[model samples]
Target chain A: MLTPLLLHVSILGLAAASALGLFATRRESPSMLGSARILAIVATLLVLALQLRRGMEFGGLPLVSRFDTLLMVAVLIVGAALSIDLTRGLSVLMIGALPVALAPLLFAAAIGMPDEHPERNLMHPAVGVHVFLTLGAYAVFGVAFVASILYLIEHRQLKARTGPSLLGMMPSLETSYRLTLRALAAGLVLLTAGIVLGYLYGRQVLSGASWRLDAKVWLTTVSWIFYVIVFGMSFVPAFKGRRTALASVACFVIVMATSWVASFWSHFHRYP
Target chain B: MELSVVGVNHRGAPVEVREQLSFEEARLPEALAELRRATGAAEAVILSTCNRVELYTVRAEGAAGAMESSHWLALQRGVPDSAIASVLYRHAGLDVIRHLFRVAGGLDAMVLGETQIIAQVKEAYRVAKDSGHADRVFNVLFQRALRVAKQIHTTTAIGAGGASVPAVAARLAGKVFQNLAQKRVMIVGAGETGEFTLAAFHERGTLDPLVVNRTVEHAERLIARFGGRAVGLDRLAGTLPEADVVITCLGSSEFCVTPDMVETAVRARRGEPIVFIDIAVPRNVHPGVNRIENIYLFDIDDLQGIVAQNISEREHELARCEPLIDSEARRALQELGEADVHEVVGRLRDAQHAMADEELRKTWPKLGALSPDQRQEIEYLLKRVTNKILHGPTTAIKEAARDGSTPVNFLEIVTKLFRIK
Candidate 1:
């Protein structure tokens, strides 16, 4: 009962924060942005508390349920947004990040908390680390996705000479570009480590099973390769500002699709 | 005391008239002393800038005081009364408060929302205070005005964007580069526009710029004024890769920076971002270069468009600031008025205490010699009665003063009733 209540409260709080963030973006009010940040912090804490309760109920970390994974992703997204340096531009970034963070929680609310625990092997330490690293990468990429969107908006505004309007509240093109590149790099590194760990664990434990044929493995590999190409294209002269932003956005979409497909179709990696 | 301002600004007079009446910074102390002496102003501050010359004074005579200060100003500056009279404007009482707030808030600036006026006002007040010309009223007024200006700028987008072409160029470059000081600047021409643009970047801490001009001598002259190395146009291609920002103002028919040149530079820089600001007629940098990755190009038209937009944004913010300033000005005036009310209240309380002591002295002779405890009880009773008697009037006076509902001469009535001299 307490876990469900916490989840609802966290969802409502994040939704309110996102609404306030959007209002702040339009009005350019520093106080309003500050309030939104505070609200997001509180909501993030509630989500974390809910996860802790579920972990206690399951006798270990709650990494098996779809609801748990989504909650973890939300926490990571909000955590990254909160932990970043609070510049004037960070307010605008939060305007994007809060909604992205809220989405996973809303999805988790729809799925509801699980009544049953997963197979024992799913709670293995290796699996737990792999899930955490992969989710951390997802959250980082999510930030990069928002940064890319802002970059595209700011880039277009500058190109069109629209002046400092609502879109002008966003960070500069250079800032947005740098943020996208850095977040992507960080996400790629985590994703690589998670994939390596997962590969090794599968080799050691599922030696007799055809784990290579799993749909999750294929989708995750494809997403990783796409991100690698996107990161590489950031260096090429032809794909710097607009093109790189576009590619990063597309890469995140692929990432989301991979996660969606993996959850429903993966033979062994499915969330119970 | 009443507050007053008498002045000529860009709106009221031309530069010739303003400069004639302007006071030099070095002569401010002498000028302030003389003005106070001549006009009998209790407090005075003179704010002189390129766009305006204002004399802020506190005196009992109100408008007459402002008028006398203006006359004194004209006579001191050797200007004919008739010549200065038509251009002179005056504000007294609460209007003086509003006007000063507007001035300090940059609403009265030549460029709307410009920030320099606040600094100038601060200096003017600093001079007055340091020279013993500013007293209680002027100190409170000027300090409140400065805080109001800061509040306006912080809460509203009044000073949002740059207003000039060079400023906009620097702003654009700032958007591209995180730290401009570390970036190398290359000026493509020796024209005045290029010099201004280079100076804008120089102010942003880009000290050494590589000057590429048709004449090495012309480039050297610019480099001499602003620290940098000079090179002829032939070195443009050789030096192109080294600069992080390139400002072009050469009046050439063809593009001085072509796409090929920029493409090669991009390759050499390893995908680092570069900004190109083209501020020349016929355009110096090639338009095609903007298409190249890592190249951000903005021409004169773009800068002007952004400037116009910024100006419009400031104007929109002015509407929002009007109500805020109006309320703040009114609140400040009431608060300052309350200070007078507080003094009157204190005098009233003191008068009651004195009257109570006098009554006790008169009654002591009529009564027989009493014990110390009995006298002490009587004294305590009298003190409580005095407080009870004053509480009703005190609350009424404070409430009336707070809400601006106090009757005219209400304090005067209280003072006369109590004989609180």
Candidate 2:
């Protein structure tokens, strides 16, 4: 069993990993990036194992609180994405996305534990499914956001007739753009399906609370509409370069904004 | 030992002159056989590439052997003895070995450190070996050359990256499309440069390409080979928008790809970036095309820029490789020197054993130990003593052999002091 001391060490390890990745990108060194990849992957595994152990102690999966579920999903996505990137020579993606993942975990630690114990709510399946799709979509967009940033950097360098400076370590502009498009397209589909499922579960499965719009729901819908336009424009044969990349990046930002609303709404709705 | 090479390469000779002097693959065997018939060389290997042809050989000891071989080679080539003599190069002993090693290492290639010539040299050796023409000396020499080439490849960074224009262009394409197999490439000419670039594109499994040339038949030939569609030059503008990469190497006097053409293509492309490489000296693509957004234009100057960088990198690696080559050459020379000692020692041991056996026969009967077995043991002891006595002198004889001058004093001392035939 990992003591509290070991868990603290794991957090430190995560910080070290983040620092290494950032340094590697700044230095434009593959050897440094390769080392950072190893450190990040190890920290992720240790953190996941600790989360799993803590999760089992509190009670089984469904009985655990929604925040725990959110935390678990975030850990799983970061772990899986980093592992995949390591194998595919996409280590630089972690440099762009992992800091965002680290932010929530660090914030939760600072805020201390929940006052109310998690109850075994009957609407468990609906909540679990909704959170799963939403977080999964976030992870996919995380990848898309990284790719878009790379595209912009590469496009600028090419325009300026200068070399890639530090950004050359990222995948090529064409590669980045294509990957962004694929991830964004997939995320849009998942988001649409997830929104529909949430409405259905609220009406039929849970108590027949009349369907009402919340800040979180409205913002999510708005982001979904933005993505739909982005996806629609991709089919136009002429608009296949920097414009497509910028559109995907814009959609990811909206997606990130929706998450902030969800977090804010979850805090108010639960605490109130 | 002296070594000299007299030959004109791509730098020194015109294409027409090189073409006239170059030996075709079909005629190489006949040439080799005639060379052997004329020169009376026990062993020879001919290294013939597009850029240069060289003959390497080992001559037996004596001035007569060198003169006869040189005369024979001049006659077989159907040139006058003086003309042939003037153009031909010769190297003897260690210098000859060093020359072969350098040639195999790609130091002698038109593009320094290019790998294609190594294979060409290997094939040349193979052809010679197959013709039952390579003797023990040539066999060892060629094998050493091949080994040295391989050593240079693994130990040095000389061959890293794509060295040629086509290869570099294709590599750039790979940076654009993560998987080139999914991309479409277009070739705008059927010239030699275009064909080379086509080969590079074809190597990437993801690219599907089309060929367009002024001559429809030539374009069709390229398209047929690569499974790409063919079109006449008239349809180049129609084809441009569909391609992700457009490479032009036409020999035309006028611009085949103009600013207006690129402007229309980019608009039609819907802001998709199209990579263009114009690798012709006369400039087949217009300079104004580069101003169009999302149209990346790289002309001959850009490729030359890369080549210059690559050459300098190779030169850096070449500095690292030179010491290795020198060490190997020095080691080979040392081995050859040691072999001379071994030969002399072997002869001395044989002479001593024979003399001991003769003396034993005469003295055995006189020694009254009686039994043949007992007598045989004494003879063996005598032979061992003779061998022990001869060992030091035999070693000295070998040391003398390496100086390459008169060892008459050393030979006289050994004969007079030992008093043996």
Candidate 3:
């Protein structure tokens, strides 16, 4: 009962904050967007705390249940975006990205909670850590995707000579371009650690589940390869700005698809 | 207390007349002393600026004529009284207060809503307070006027728009770029208007502008103030691609920045936008150059139109501010009235009550045997006695608050004699 109520409240608050942020994009007033950013952060923190408490009650992590995992992913997305906003003062960017974070929570709120989440069985601790790391990596990429969009918008305004509407609100194109690279590297490292941990746990716990036979294995590997390509290209001077922004947008989309389709089909991810 | 102003301003006098009447800072003390000696005014403040010279004074007699200030100005500056009298303007009481508010609010300035006059007023008031030329009357008046100036800008849109061409140009630049601190400017001419616009931009960020002129020496001299490099007109083409903003002002009849020049710069820039402001008389940049991709060009007339629209906006905002100023001024006058009632006399009354309360507290334990009702009756008696004793003086003070001419300082003498803490 408490989980459903908290989930609903978090969804509503996140939705309001995102809407206010959209309105504030045109306004130069910091107070207007500041209010929205604070509300979203508070909502995100409250939901994360509730989810952690639920994890402790269940004797393990919240990633055991599908609804629980989705809600926690929403919290992680908002939490990472809030941290970036605090450091860079990018309330506008937070506003742009928060709606994407809110989607999972809204979906969870509508479905409510199951009496017993079979995914909540803490059969293996290593798999729990792998799930947490992967979710965190996905959250980081969501924020990076927003920063990429900002870079593209600024680039477009400068290209079209449209007298600086979006340009005035966003950070410089160089700043956004650099942020995309930093976020991509950070996301790649976490995803790699999660995959390595997943493989180790699979060998110890699974009965004859090989990378060739499991859908989740090859999909995760493909996503990892794409990240490596992007991470390597960032070092090349010519492939720096527009190419990086495009790669960030494209890579995140592929990663999202891989997570959903691979996890749905993987027998190894289900509890025994 | 009486309020009055004797001044010569831009509206009433020519530049030559104002120059003759102006007093330097070194000569102000002697000028003030002579004016006081001649007018026999109780308190005075002299405000001097490039556009106006004014003397504000308070006299107890309430019969000070404008001729007294006029004669004093003529005698001290060694000018004929008849010559100074021709362009003199005078105000008294409420009119003087209104004039000061208007002056501080920039309604009476040569440039509508200019900020410099308020600073000048503050400086004048500071000098008067430091030199012992102003007392309580002038202090309250000038301070309230300053507050009114602040309130006018904040609560209304009177200061929401730029009233000058330079200010409009700077605002336009702010709209063009997100972070102006990182942007570089290239100035193609050394005209005064361009310099004014550059000065306005200085308030936003420190800009080391690249200045180009027909004469290399002239550009060097102008760019020295900003710690920037000076380039010759021949180098303008090469420098165009590097500059994020370009302002051109040439005295020649021919266009200096043609389509070919802009096309070359744009090709080098690839797609980065550049702002061009041509403030010259015959127009330094060709009008057709605005058709170029990634180039924004504005002529003098475009800036003037922005200025006109800005002025219209400020005028609409002024309508909103006038009522606020009127109500605020009225409230200030009422508060000043109440302050007259409180200041020294209220402090003495407080001290008297504190002394009485102490005496009663020392004897409070002795009244323990008395019933609560009996003790309350005694306390009531004490309060009535204190009120009766102060009734005459407090009534007189309240009267003085309403009528400024009433002798409010008699309570000052009472406070001093009693050695009230």
Candidate 4:
């Protein structure tokens, strides 16, 4: 009963924070933004607590369930976004981050948790590291995706010469672009390490099973290549502003597809 | 005492008339003293800016005080009374409170929601205070007006965006760069518009901007006024790579900055972002330069468009600010009124106790054979009776004040009935 109540409260908190954040951006109100930030922090902490409880119940890291994965990703996104806001005074990013963080939780709620959890080997430390690293990369890329979207909106508004209030509430174009590149760089490094560890683990566990042909593996590789290209294009002068923002947005879509949609068809990477 | 404001603002007067009535800051103290003496005002503050010349005063309650203040302002400024008679406006009591609050909050500014007027108002108050013209009533009035202005700005989006061309240019630069102070700025002309743009940048902490003009002497003159190395127009290409922001207003028909030049600068800077603000009439920078990577370009029309949009937004916020200012003015008037009522109530209570003490003293001598304990009981009884007699009127006056009734008239009635001078 207590666990369910905590889950409901966490979800409600995130939903309220997302709503308030959007309103704050539209109204350009600092006090409302402050309230949203506090709500987001409380919700993020509750989500972390839920994850810890699940890990304790599973006797290891809770990486075998889709609900667990989504919850972990949501926590990381809010945590990273909050850290940036607090440290750098970029509270405007919360306008995008809060809604993005709430999406995964809402999705998890829509698809209820599996009744009988699939039993899997959770003793391998390498697998744990790989899962955690990969999810962390996704969360960071989610922030990059948000920054890219904000950059595009602000760029369009500047080009059209409208929406002064909206423009005032957004971060600068250069700031958003710089944030995208920073997040992409950090995500790229972590993803590379996670992929390398996952490859080693795959070879050890599924030897001679043609695991390389797995749909999840192919989609993950494609997303990784897209991110690599986006990161590389940041250095090219011709693709600096709008093109780079668009590329970041497209690449994150691919990342999301790889993580959620591609997992269903993979025989070896199934999660209940 | 009653509060009054009599003046001519931009809404009521033309520049020709306003300039005639404008006060020199150096002579403000003498003018303030003269104003008080002429109008028999207990306190006064003369706020004279480019757009308005207002004399705020506190004096005996009557229409005569406002009329006298208006005539004094025009006569002191050496303008004929007939010159400003039609344009002069007067507000007394609550209207005075509302008008001052709106002025301080920038709602009455030529540019709605502009912030400079707040500083100007502050300086005016400071002058009044230093000259000993600001006393209890003006002090409370001006301080509350400043606080209301701050609250309005903080809680509303009325001051969110730039409302002028030069300001919009700086705002555009801010959008393209994270930290403007560290960025190198290049001014491609030495005209008045260029100077204004440079001043806008300097206000944001970009002090040393490169001044480039066709005439080396002109560049040097600008450099002397604002700190920066002067460069001739021939060295534009050599210095282009070092500047993160370029503001051009050379008033030339030819394109001073072309795509080729920006491409070379981009290659030299290794793809660092650069913003070109071409505020020239014939367009100083080529339109094709906007296509270059890491280059953002805006012209005069673009800056004006943003300024127009920002001004419209500020105007829309006035609806939100009006109600807030109205409520605040009402609340401030009530508080100030309650303060006066409290003083009168204290006087009334003191008078009642004094009368009771006198009566008790006279009776105690008559009862010469009374014991010490009996005398003490009689003193306590006298004090309690005095308090009970004053309590009903005090409660009625306070309740009237709190309910937003005719508090001033009610306090007057109480003061007259009790004869509590």
| Number of the top lDDT candidate | 1
Give the better candidate number (1 or 4) by TM-score: 1
What is candidate 4's lDDT per residue for B1-421, written digit by digit as tens? 6788999999999999999999999999999998888888889999999999999998855436334887787777788888899999999888999999999999999988988899999999999999999988888888999999999999987887888888888888888788888888899998798889888998888858898889878887778877889888999998999899999999798999999998999988878888898999999999898877668888888888778888888889999999998998898888888888789889999989988988887887678888889888989988898888778989888888888776446666777798988
Better of 1 and 3 by lDDT: 1
lDDT of 1 by residue, B60-115 (tens): 53235344888898899999889989889999877898999999999989888999
Off by over 4 Å in 3: A15-34, A63-91, A94-104, A118-272, B3-119, B134-183, B198-208, B214-218, B224-227, B241-244, B250-328, B343-386, B389-421
Summarize candidate 2's per-residue lDDT along B1-421 as a digit string, tens digits.
1222234356565565445456677777777777666655555566767877676655433314444544554454454566544445556666766777777888767778878888988988888888866766666667877899898876675765456788767766565666777788898888888888878888887455888888888786787678778888999998888898888988889999998988888888777778888898799888877777677677766665666676777788888788877777656655554553465466667778888888877886687667878777787789779978986777567656655353423444454465544
Question: Comparing 2 and 3 by lDDT, which wins?
Answer: 3
Per-residue CA lDDT of model 1 for A4-45, tens digit only, reads: 899999889999999998998788888998899899999999
**Model 2 misplaced stretches (Cα beyond 4 Å):** A1-140, A149-176, A185-229, A249-265, A268-272, B1-8, B11-21, B27-43, B58-64, B67-73, B80-102, B133-239, B242-273, B278-294, B324-421
Ranking by DockQ: 1, 4, 2, 3
Error of 1 at B1 (Å): 0.8
* DockQ of each two-chain model: 0.46, 0.23, 0.09, 0.44
**Candidate 4 docking quality: incorrect, acceptable, medium or high:** acceptable
State which candidate has the highest DockQ: 1
The A-chain TM-scores of all the candidates are 0.96, 0.82, 0.92, 0.95
Cα error, candidate 4, residue B154 (Å)? 1.7
TM-score of 2: 0.66
Best-to-worst lDDT order: 1, 4, 3, 2
Name the lDDT value of residue B223 in candidate 4: 81
TM-scores for all candidates: the values are 0.91, 0.66, 0.71, 0.91
TM-score of 1: 0.91
